[model samples]
Target chain A: MLRLHGIVGDRRDHALHHRLHHLEHHDAIEFLFVPEADLGRRRLRALTDRGTECAVSLDRDDALYDGAVLFIDDDRAVVVRAGAPRELRLRPQGTEGALKLGFLAGHLHWRVRFEGTDLCVVLDGAAADYTARIAPLLDDGIVTVVGNAN
Target chain B: MNAPALSPATPAKTAPAARVGIGGPVGSGKTALVERLIAAFAARKVDLAVITNDLVTHEDAERVRRSGLIDPARVSAVEAGACPHTVIREDPTLNIEAADDLERRFPGVELILIESGGDNLASTFSRDLTDFWIFVIDVAGGDDIPRKRGPGVLKCDLLVINKADLAPHVGVDLDGMIAEARRVRAGRPVIVTNCRRSEGIDAVADHLEREVLFRT
Candidate 1:
């Protein structure tokens, strides 16, 4: 299990904007003092060893986690796992690919709700008809509990 | 305190230009209520856009788009995927993105009314998502509704008592319902409307002017 604690008190929150603007400046990168941000080094190492460029989340809201499939290193835009993250790993059919998915699935605070055709979506909180939809996603590994911070 | 240094320097995101949310139980005239607000706001030259969520399809959004009240492009539909409250309240990132996209496409838009997929008496909007939100419940829904004190009834900025025209037919007392709603809300604001005939829309718009646009 990846233990990423100390995020609640970290000042990295202030630098997200600066990094978002700078080419060399990366938001959530070198900005995270939170120990809970890292997925276990073993999994990330195995994937990188197989040439899969992996990114761990530095904050919860860079995107809502309800239906998150994977994070990309290039732009960090979350995608529905359209086999895109698999392609990032030069070896598509290796343990590295499966391990990445494992790390994502194991995370409880990742905040995603799985839907039709296995579409993992960033959960919507404002909708009135939202409860009925999230009920089942909670049962599927697709939905996870996340975002305890203010 | 270092207020400026604590928050991002970027311009704070303002509330969407035009957002009017119609929330009520299934068939309390949420869609019909939206149609009337569209026509009323339009009559005043308020540029507008709309969003609707349904159980499984574009049923609500498509209905409005076909009404010819507004351009089809101005109307967008979001599938609730089951949870209606979540899309409008807790984490409204998707709705925010949709409203932002609408504002980008139609810079002239003065309002974007978000109609919640019909929900129960307990539903309400989060301030983070909307500058102003209106809750629609009908006299026919029962005068006891206001007395029950659901969050949607009490918390909305404006509590709209719709379907007033049908009150007598359904044995509802419009006057008493309005009085009770006012009492429960601690006299914030309430409007009665017969959306089917466009009655009482002016009061609703007037409330918007005073409360949302600060026209007063």
Candidate 2:
């Protein structure tokens, strides 16, 4: 059962999450509300045994693990906590012209716009003086970092 | 006859002092109630700590801290993650942990008051988490609320109808509302108060003294 077990955010959010957890974890899926106050891996295992699929919704802006069931109540604020195994989102930022040139050379074409920092940004920063850093490796499955105003 | 002998194989455990919860909609005067309890408990010299849940702001927690009745650090606030009922009822893990943390921080504390974030009806505390609880509603919401009989109102140990002074201005029949509340709960305790003015606080305190604090 997909029991929400417990909400991570605040005390007043239990019922709705309980309802959501129960609804998602329906018959045959044993749902248990585990308050983090008393949470342990053993508790997670216990729920897993109750049902095959285990899903937990985290607190507001909270990210624990990217479990099967994620509770997204509102999107106006930053997600401080997401129960997903890995919370992936776009990040944005503003930098000097040279930094922007290197940044674009690394990920100029992308599916989603994000201000996040990854290996690409880190590499780009280190190779700031090298002009042909990424151009040669772009087609070879190797991401390169080159910053030039051309 | 002699009492049964203790078993040698039994595990030893501390009787963790009971935890009590107080919840209700916003503007129902939960902070005011806490203030009153602080004064009342101080009169009785009870050692206690309070945990408050604020959905979008720390105003309530701040109020109790600044009240000067208890140490400001004795109060901690938890954010509601935009969904108040989930934290208190559905999940309640963070609140439980916070309460336990407080217990760890202050061993002398005998009473714990967990205030839920301001939320709508249908909010209730977990029996496993809280030993007893109270729900506060207000006259400003109208007198028919009792008749609606939300789960929170029906399940709470004490139902407080706060802001009594606004009944006439708000066009509510205060007597009828209180009577209907009694009718709904059958024999449960209900208190009418103007928490803003500190009226009817002692009666509420009296109920807590007997029911939760176990001073009797």
Candidate 3:
């Protein structure tokens, strides 16, 4: 079993991205899919695409994110891909609502991304857990769920 | 309880240093306590590092570094910006990163003291950031503080009632305040300290040695 200590670099880095692009052509890159809930975990045990056993123990401060390169060599590379997460899509009424929604999300430290005027919350836990927190905003009509809450 | 020794079959790995957080309101002597702890830990010859979260400047970090107690290189500072509690509680990534940097720079360090920016009594440290945390509240703040039962007063591993020397001058009943604190915490430990005189510091250091460092 390979014991991985920390990430090499993020795939978003231009240099690393170029390296990954080159590795893709040779099929030298292997991926380890981790659940969204486990992204914050410091220690994890998982298997690579090629069934390579791996034990990941990162520093207490380190958190794995999508496109995190775990290991790479001239011949092969391993990257972490976050599994699909349950998302909560919300559309705030206006600027005031947007600020409120943002504040709520920031306070809860919820992972979020904005697409146009819509806010997409990538849930680390059950949908109800996220919904319950923003229920007040929903009740106030400051924000509306755009799709299935789950 | 002490962690069991790793089996001979297991590959040796350096254990991460224990992270301890000190959080409290403004002017509550949080930095003073840090200075005192530096001297105390120095006397014991403990390998220690410090991380200070200042609201908008490196004032606390600079003071500790210039104190001639610990190495200036061993002290790191994190600017907490506007929301001090957010950096320590809601999202502690910055503080955690600072501590990790300290551990990497000083491999032999056994303890890292993280001091949060001065905040209200409700502020508390996230468990991910600290293995053990101490909340400082001084008698000058008010005897009613512990009675308020803020999360910092209730949830902290240790509650330090600093400024013990000013109890009478401030019209605070020290014994009654300590009693109320004990009652609110349901018999958890509370220590009173006069940082000016270094009184009660030994007890605080002893608690850390026993609980955090596991030096029984």
Candidate 4:
């Protein structure tokens, strides 16, 4: 039974490095990847299949990139995964359309992006189901498409 | 019914430099205000350095560095990675590190101005990032801005209405806008400024000197 706590970067000065190296050499292992959005303010994340929980306490400013490993043990390890990218593509008809869309995304705490004439929001899961949620908030001329970018 | 008595703690250590934040919507005169502040603070012989956050480019920081108002070395730019608000509010570590580096390089610096990447009404600085902050909005943005009562407008230490000269051209009554701003703020101070002519700048400088810098 291993209790994982904090990111490797957060515990660089601790003796856990030696333990992690020794654990990595073991063959019997289970890997779990937690999506970035799910890794919110919670210090403990429950891994259902493993029937165990890992505590992730990265520094306040540390960014969890795609595929960031959070824990490593003799039998299991937890990873931070960005998951599939779903974006809301918007087309505004009026002069203020682009600005309004950008503002609305930021106001709603969504990460905004622009590719040529289209404004995009990397969808925040069910919390920001923009197709079912945000499209109605815009004026008539604005068009919204929610799907894979590629 | 009485409030608990306060306890006096150990003597506090003097802080390094004072940090001020400037934030507002795009095209709202945030960079202009920074330029004006640089000159004004320099004229008063205040030691100053600046950190700028740009959404995807270093254009704003480059403009200030090229302005000849202060040494180019005194300005540093942090890319917001397109999430401007997060860099200033949610996770200000990048900005904190930048400011710490600036202070380390210029030990005599008494002030550091952090300019946020152009953002919307909800944008604000984290308390951990700035000692005081000013939210700038312009007449061209429409007088309804204050009436909207966005967090930046309602919660900033000071609110500045810039481009006062454009009020007439934009069909906005400057007096009505200022009146509504005051009403929404519950009588907090609002300064009207035409940064182009440097009107009402001294008042802003005076406020910072007295309130933030404690000059006199």
TM-score of chain A of 4: 0.41
DockQ score of candidate 1? 0.01
Which should have the higher TM-score, number 1 or number 4? 4
- Residue-wise lDDT of candidate 4 within A1-150, one digit each (tens)? 223333543223356545544543442122344455434322223342233333333333344554455655444344444555556677766666667766666665454567778777654355346655556545455655534543
Question: Could you give the CAPRI-style class of model 4?
Answer: incorrect
Per-residue lDDT of model 2, residues B1-216, tens digit only:
111122232221223444667888878888788888888778888788898888878878898999899998889888877688788888888888888888889886767888988777788887656767889999999899889989889988789999999999999999999999999999788999898788998898787766554444
Candidate number that wins on DockQ, 2 or 3: 3
Roughly what TM-score does model 2 have, to 2 decimal places?
0.55
Residues B1-216 of candidate 1: C-alpha lDDT, one tens digit per residue: 000112111221232364656677888888987888888888887888998877679998889999999999999888778778888887777777787789899986767888888899888776545656888898878889999999999888788888898888989888888899999999978988888888888888877755554334
Q: What's the alpha carbon RMSD for model 3?
A: 14.9
Q: How close is candidate 4 to the true structure, as a TM-score?
A: 0.57
Return the TM-score for chain B, candidate 3.
Answer: 0.93
Query: Clash number for model 2?
Result: 47
Ranked by TM-score, the better of candidates 2 and 4 is 4
Q: What is the lDDT of candidate 1?
A: 0.58
Q: lDDT score, residue A132, model 4?
A: 53
